[model samples]
Target: MKLLEVKNLIKHFPVKNHKGQVVHAVDDVSFHINEGETLGLVGESGCGKSTCARTIIRIYDPTGGEIIFDGQNLATLSQRELKPIRKNMQMIFQDPYTSLNGRMTVRDIIAEPLIAHKIGNSQKERHEMVAQMLKQVGLNTEHGTRYAHEFSGGQRQRIGIARALILKPKLVICDEPISALDVSIQAQIINLLTEFQQKEKLTYLFIAHDLSVVEYISDHVGVMYLGKLVELSESKELYKNPLHPYTQGLLASIPALDIHAGKITDKAEMSGDLPSPISLPSGCRFCGRCPYAKKICAEAEPPMKEAAPGHMVACYLYS
Candidate 1:
């Protein structure tokens, strides 16, 4: 079942000292995540992947479009109205150092969600629940008294995961959850998240710049560029047959030693800096740097259309 559906989602930030100019963080983007499946969103840094995730989770109010979660439109809901719905949704932020509370013990940090939603009846009850969550995330109950700073980066992330899952949220937005950790530690975190998903039957919107990690964990993959969803397809299909030029360039940039050797056919290397979001081009956002850009690519933008079965791309070349 589709657990979260975002349609034509738009989020724009006003440029400082520039009247009437805005940074188009996420513009007319759309996708969905079904229950118990993972949807990985990948793009270059500053491509609005994190912004899309935040807007979906309501950290930032969307500028336009619909956000439907479990059949309810959340775009226009008031904060009071959103509170109840938030229990079924949670986010694991990118930075573990800043995401957790240092002043609070590990126990209180994990129990905050429970307290906010009034889950447990008594203090002792909540403590037990926190303890169980700690264990589930690979921490001991004794560590509950320690501060977030006392733990390593990996352990702190585990605490963050425990906090997010304490409420048993149906949808979890993992915003580059493993970006800050060591290479060795990244695998552990990924495995932990995978284990929890299977056990809890959770759905994930995993956002990252690392395509390798996204491919390993995601059932479907969506490629974004300059606030637009350029392409989307099943994980294997996207890696095997990336239609969009941007998607092809992204895959080519991946180290050749990557497990999927000889899979990428074309050397669609991207050049030049990304176009500024504040003053976007009238045509395709990637036209400025695309190697295969034609006159039509500069004349008008292309809408996302299916180029193959289960594969969608937004480019004039496909049209």
Candidate 2:
């Protein structure tokens, strides 16, 4: 079952000074997340990974597109109409330090969702729910009495997890949830998320810059370049054989240890910086930096097409 379907998702921010020009943060991006599966979205910074998540969750009004969640068109729902839908969906933010409330106690932070949704019958009931959630996320009940600032980065993220899962939401959007933590703690957090997903039958849309991390957690992976999805495939298939140039570059960039030879190899290096979203190229957004760009690539954009079994790529090379 498709839990969430985003079709032709377009999100644009108006240029500050330009009258009609807009920043194409996300344009014509499409993907879907199946029930109890993870869809990992990977992209370089400023490629609109976070913007896409935000718009799908209705944090920002989309410029155009369809956001269908649980068979309902969330893009057309009013704020009041979205209240119940919000209860079934939750997000764990990227920064543990900034995402949690420093002023509020851990108990309060975790209870906010329950309070907003009126899940508990009374204050005592809510506290019990929070305590159970704290334990589930690998934190102790006693820790709930302390403020968010009192915990380490990993612990703080655990609190964020507790908050998100308190509602028992069917869909969770993990927006780079493990990026800011210590390297040693990253695995632990991922393991915790995995455990919860299995236990709760959760569907996740995980966004991250780390390809390895996404591969570990995602069932399917989508590659984004300059606000467009360049490629998408099964996680294992994508790692074994990346179809798009941008996806190949990303996989190559991952640091690998060569114990026998004592050196790394197979890094597909590219030249040039990312172009500004406001003044994008006329044809392919990635043509500016793609090493194999041809005259045709500069003259016409390529549509995303199936390259292999369940593998999608948008490139003139495949077209």
Candidate 3:
């Protein structure tokens, strides 16, 4: 059974312009993650990858559509009603430095989730669990006694991971978890996350801008453009055979070594700026930058159609 299902999810932020307008951050996006599977969401900054992750975790209310998790529609659940459900879902924010509370000790930060969920009876038991968790994430209990500021970037992130995994949540939303770290640190964090996922049977909605990293860590990949999911397929298939022009352009940007010369190849070039989300062009969201966009593409929106089994795309060319 699918552990998480999102249908036509829309998240728009209202802004007051000359006339009240909405920022189309996430629009009509739909996808699902099976039990213990990782779904990688990749797009440029402000393409709604982070917004989509936040909405799924109910950090922001959905403007429309359903966020079905574990058979419950989380979008409609009230704060009071969603309390228990929050324990099953956790988020590892983008910036490790900002995500941790500098004022609090690492132990408290790691134990906070358990307290909020009312897990483990007493403070002593929670502290004990924190010690165990610290060890699990390659941290010492003595380190947990110190403040978050004392640790390096990599260690702080490990603290964040320990906190998120403390409750053993079934679904985790990793919002560019390794983006801010050094290249070497990034690999360490990725390996740690992979280990935890296997041990816990966790499902992940991994949001990232690096296609290479996404392909490495994901089972399936979803390409987003201007808040809409333009393409989705198994990670290997999506990298090998991208159907959407935007997906092709993204993959083309990856540095591929020329075996004969040991040099990088040409990147797929894109022209024009991203259109304002508030006043998005008619029809396809990517038409403004898509090389293969036709007149019909600018006239009306194209529905998501399957070009191959288990591979979906939202582009006029495919239709």
Candidate 4:
């Protein structure tokens, strides 16, 4: 069963203008995350991956489209009505420093969500729950009394994960959760997340700009460009055989261990500044950078078509 389903999701931020110009942050993107599966949303910075995640969670109310979670539409719910549903969904933000409260101790930070949701009535129960969660994430109960500022970047992220998972949320949106940490610490955080997912049967919508990292953790992957998904496929299939020119370009950029092995003769290199989202190109959003872009690519948007079983790409070259 699908835990979350998003269709034609659109989010636009109004610019500072008397005429009310809007930035098309995320436009008409669609995907789904199945229960107990991790669907990685990968894209370059400013390509709307973060915006899409935020809109689905209603952090920014979507301008249009359907956000269906567990067979119910999230866009239709009022703030008050959405509160209960929020308990079942949680977000682990990118930067631990900004996402956490410096003034609050680790215990208070983790317990706040539990308190807000009224998961446990008594303070004693909350404290016990916090202690257990701290241990679960490789921290001791003693560490809980320390303020977030006292901990290392990795430790602070552990606190963030503990807080997000304390409610046992079914769907966790990890928005570049390890991007701000040290390279050595990235694996530890990823391992912790993997362990927890297996233990709790959690589903994840993992968003990242790093395709390599996304490939390591995701069961399936979606590549986004200028507010649209250009390619999507199983993690192994996508990495082994990326069909779209954009996807191929992204793969080519990744530093491979074997410099000589499995190298494609024609490496696609993308150039030119990303066109402004406010005034997107008429046809393919990637046309400006795609090497194989044709005349039709400048005149008509290509519909996402299946190139092989379970593999899909949006490009006129495929048609």
Candidate 5:
């Protein structure tokens, strides 16, 4: 069953004092995540990865397109209509330090969702629920009485995870949940999320720039560049053979150790910064930085086409 299906989703931020000028944050991107599946969205900073996730979860209202989740079109729903639906979907924001409330105790933070949705009958019951969730996320129940400021970065993140999962949401959008953590702590959080997914039969839309981490957790992976999906395929397939030039560039940039050569192989073959979203290129968004650009690439945008079974790419070379 498809838990979430985003079709031609668009989100644009208007430019200040510039009539008719808008930042194309997300443009006509489409993808889907089946129940109990994970889809990892990857790209450099400001590639609209987070914006896409935010739009789907209704943090920012989409400018256009459909947000179909659990057989309903959320794009058309109003705030009142969406309140009930919001419980089925939750988001783990990027910054753990800011995502949680400093004033609220850990118990109150985890129980907020339950209180909002009216999950428990009394305060004692909700406290018990929060305590259990704390233990599940590897936090001590005694810590629930403490404020978020008192915890370490990893411990704070664990609290955030507990709060997100306390409701047992059907779909969770993890927006770089571990990027701010220490390298050693990243794996523990990832492992915890994976374990929860297996036990709860949860579905996820995991967004991250770490290709290795994405490959490990995602069933399917989508590569975004300049607000467009340049490539998408099964995790192994996409890693083995990245079709889009942007995708290729991203994969090539991943550091690989060469023990025999006695040097770390880290080469970012693609050059040049991203073009201004205010005045985007007439054709492909990545044309300016693409090494394999053709004349037509600057004249017309390439449509996403399936180059092989279950592998999709947006490039004139594929067409």
Candidate 6:
């Protein structure tokens, strides 16, 4: 069952001091996250992965698109109408330090959402809920009295998780949840999230710049480039046999220890800096950097098409 669906999502930020010029952060992106499934969204920096996640959660009002959550069109909802829906959708921000309030105690930070939504009337009830959530994310209940700044990076993230999951949201947008933690702590966070998903059947839109991290937690994976989804498939299938030229290049960039590995010897690498989003390429956004670019690729954009069973690619070569 599809828990959340996004269609043709677009978000453009106007360039400062540049009249009529806008940074195209997200463009014509679409994907669905199933109930109890994780859809990992991966891309390089400035590829619009974060923008996509924020737009879905209404943190950034989309320039244009449809966000359907649990059969309701979020785009059409007024602020009042959205209040209830917001409870079912939550975001776990990428930077735990900035996301948490320094002035508020850990208990108050985690209980804010519940109070905002009027989930509990009394302080005692909210306290109990916060304490239970703290333990669930592997934090001691006593830590709730401490300020967010008092904890380490890993511990701060645990508090963030506790807040995000306190309401038991159906969709959690984990935006690079483990990116800032220590390498050793990363595994613990990943395992905790996986364990929670198994126990609560939680769904996630896991966004990250790291493909390897996405592969570990995702059931399906989508590769984004310049605000567009270039390829999507089952996690293992996408990693093993990427189709788009951009996807292929991204996979090759992954470090390999053995020099004699049977990977693509003449790896396709993107050249030239990414074109300014304010002024994208004429047709395919990636045409300028694509080694396989042809006249048609520069003349017209290619629509996404199924290149293989359960594998979709957006390129003229596949079309």
lDDT scores of the candidates, listed in order: 0.94, 0.92, 0.92, 0.91, 0.93, 0.89
lDDT per residue for candidate 1 within 1-319, as digits (tens), equals: 9999999999999888988999999999999999999999999999999999999989899999999999999999988999999999999989999999879999999999999999999999999999999999999999999999999999999999999999999999999999999999999999999999999999999999999999999999999999999999999999888889899999888877756556664568888888888888988999988989998888889988999999999998888
Which window of ten consecutive residues has the lowest lDDT sum in model 5? Answer: 259-268
| Candidate 5 Cα outliers beyond 4 Å, as residue runs | 259-268
lDDT, candidate 6, 147-206, per-residue tens: 999999999988999899999988889999989889898898889989989998999999
lDDT at position 253, candidate 3: 72
Give me candidate 2's TM-score against the actual structure: 0.97
Model 3, 230-257: lDDT tens per residue? 9999998898788888888887777666
Clash counts for all predictions: 0, 0, 0, 0, 0, 0
Q: What residue pairs are clashing in model 4?
A: none
* Model 1 per-residue lDDT at 157: 93
TM-score of each: 0.98, 0.97, 0.96, 0.97, 0.97, 0.96
Best by lDDT: 1
Model 5, span 1-319: residue lDDT tens = 8999999999999999999999999999999999999999999999999999999999899999999999999999998999899899998888889999999999999999999999999999999999999999998999999999999989999999998999999999999999999999999999999999999999999999999999999999999998999899999999877788888888778767654652223323789898888899999999999888899999999999999999999999988
User: Which candidate would rank higher by lDDT, 1 or 4?
Assistant: 1
Better of 1 and 5 by TM-score: 1
Per-residue accuracy of model 4 over 174-196 as CA lDDT, tens digit each? 99999999989999999999999
What is residue 62's positional error in candidate 1, in angstroms? 0.6
Q: What is the C-alpha RMSD of each candidate to the true structure, in Å?
A: 1.3, 1.5, 1.7, 1.2, 1.8, 1.4
- Model 2: per-residue lDDT, tens digit, 57-112? 89999989999999999998899999999999999999999999899999999999
Model 4 has an lDDT value of: 0.91
